[model samples]
Target: MEIATYILVPFILFALTGLKVMNEYERGVRFRLGNYSGVVNPGLRYIIPVIDTMQKVDLRVKAVDVPSQDAMTKDNVSVNVNAVLYYKISDAKNAIIEVEDFKFAVSQLAQTTMRDIVGETTLDRLLSERESVSLRIKELVDKASDPWGIKVNSVELKDILLPSDMKRVIAKEAEAEREKRAVIIKAEGETIASVNLSKAAKTLAGNKGALHLRTLQTLNDIASDQNNTIVLALPLEILESFRGKNK
Candidate 1:
């Protein structure tokens, strides 16, 4: 009984070692006798304990945050930029066979590509045209990593840091632009007011009593504020009217 018990325990342990269970999101890359066998899908799988080995790979979309990298823009502005990358493993076999470490390789490639793209772009465009730059980065990265079975879905520019001097310069430039626009608007308003004033003068001269009526309205407006005193030098028209009224 003792001899039979020892034999059964060893057999049971060996059988248990051959069984492997994979989840739905995982695929096993199998190798038999050190030669590539193929992929084993999720389910109950068996491999010879000493002759076969398997590596499990998760087939799911992943988000990778790229660290900030310093780069000089085409206009010679130095800036720090970081981004996020979304990718998935399209082909598990090539991912393992072609790249030593797929995730690290993709990250390094993304960093270099970002710096390259930033170097060719102006600071203004990089700040304003962020979406286009991100799309371009995604395209370049996807193309470069395609061989390693990485499918880059999208890339987003996370943050852009500018120097303090650059920020101050930009603020000053914006302030100057606002002041320029205000001056133009004020000048336009003055031009319109002058044009209306010219028309008003012409209308008053064409009509007999319009100027006197306007003068009376102005006096009325000044008199509405009782706390103020107004001095007026009566015009010759007003004097003539007063003389005619007396006659």
Candidate 2:
């Protein structure tokens, strides 16, 4: 019984040592004798004890937040900006082997690219054409990360920190622009109203009775206001004075 017990103990230890379970989203890279061995699929996988090792790599999307970095604009304005990067490990093998740390390297690349892009664009362009900036950043980041088998899905500007003075200046400029637009709009409205009034005058002049009706309408409007005193100059009153003077 002792001999059978000893034999079963070694067998059980070996069985447990060789067992490895991989999840659905994980791929196991096996190394046999410190040499490359094919990847093992999900579910139960066996490896020789003390002779083989497994490294599990996750094949999932990852979000990397780039810390705020100071950059100078083309106009020589200094600003701090931060961004977020969405990426995925497309080729687990290259991701694990090509770069020492893919995430770190990509982050550093992103930081550099951000500075480079900022240096090439003016502050106004950066604020107004943010989509173009984002595209440029994504392109540069993706190009740099492609070798590591990482796909940068997108790059978004999280925040842009401008100087207080610059902010105040921009605000004032915006206010002035708004005031200018308001004045232009008001002038346009007045011009349109004047044109409409001229058209109505021409129409009323074509029919003298319409002009009298319009004058009566104005009198009615004033009367409806419930005023104490009212003054009106009717065409007949002027015509009667002219007739009396001619006689």
Candidate 3:
């Protein structure tokens, strides 16, 4: 009985000390005697007191804020840009074995990729096509970090700060563009109006009585105004007939 007591007590102590609890969002990368072993799932797990080891890796997605980086656009404009990135570890084993620090590695890769993309794109496209630029950054970063077991979900450009002079210049350019369009539209309307007026004049000239009736209509319109007094003009033939009758 004494022999069994000694053996059982030591076994119970070792077992209790080796107990490891992992949460639902955690995965364990087990290593035995410095050799890579298979991953352990969530819940109570066991490891030998001095022979086995485990590193916990969170499976949840992480949000990383990339700092503003100074970059020159293809059009030679200087700007500062920052972004937010979403990533998660796809393979816990590769993430541990392949990279020294997976989080730092991924972040550095994102920064460089963003700068490179910004350098390649012009200021106009960078501002107008922000979604496309972000998608491009996501793709390049995701591809580069695939070997490190990282999965880049999305990238968002939070802000792009331009130079003060550049802002004023863009504003002026936009204003000029609007003014140009307005001038063109007004000129087109005037041209159409002139063409219609010319056609109406030609039609009226073809009929002799049309001019007389149009003159009467103009006089009638003027007479509608209380402030204006219209005068009548008698034709020379009508005046001669009146003089003859009086004689």
On lDDT, the candidate that comes out on top is: 1
Model 1: runs farther than 4 Å from truth?
Answer: 1-4, 191-220, 227-247
Residue lDDT tens for model 2, 1-247: 9999999999889879989998889888788898878787889889888889887888888898988999999999999999999898887777877898888998999999998999999999999999899899999999988989899999999899999999999999999999999999999999999999999999997887888899899888888896798685768658869999999
lDDT of 3 by residue, 1-247 (tens): 9999999999999878989999999899999999988998999989887889999999899999998999999999999999999999999998999999999998899999999999999999999999999999999999999998899999999999999999999999999999999999999999999999999899887875886688788878888888757578665458779999999
| Reference-based TM-score, model 3 | 0.77
Which segments of model 2 are wrong by more than 4 Å?
A: 226-229, 236-247
- Top candidate on TM-score is 2
Clashing pairs in 3: none
Candidate achieving higher TM-score, 2 or 3: 2
Q: Name the weakest run of 10 consecutive residues (lDDT summed) in model 2.
A: 229-238
The candidate with the higher TM-score, 1 or 2, is 2
What does the lDDT read for residue 138 in candidate 2?
A: 97
Best first by lDDT, ranked: 1, 3, 2
Question: Over the stretch 1-247, how does candidate 1's per-residue lDDT look in tens digits?
Answer: 9999999999899978999999999888889998989998999989889899998888899999999999999999999999999999989898988899999999999999999999999999999999999999999999999999899999999999999999999999999999999999999999999999999999998876887788789888888887758567589577889999999
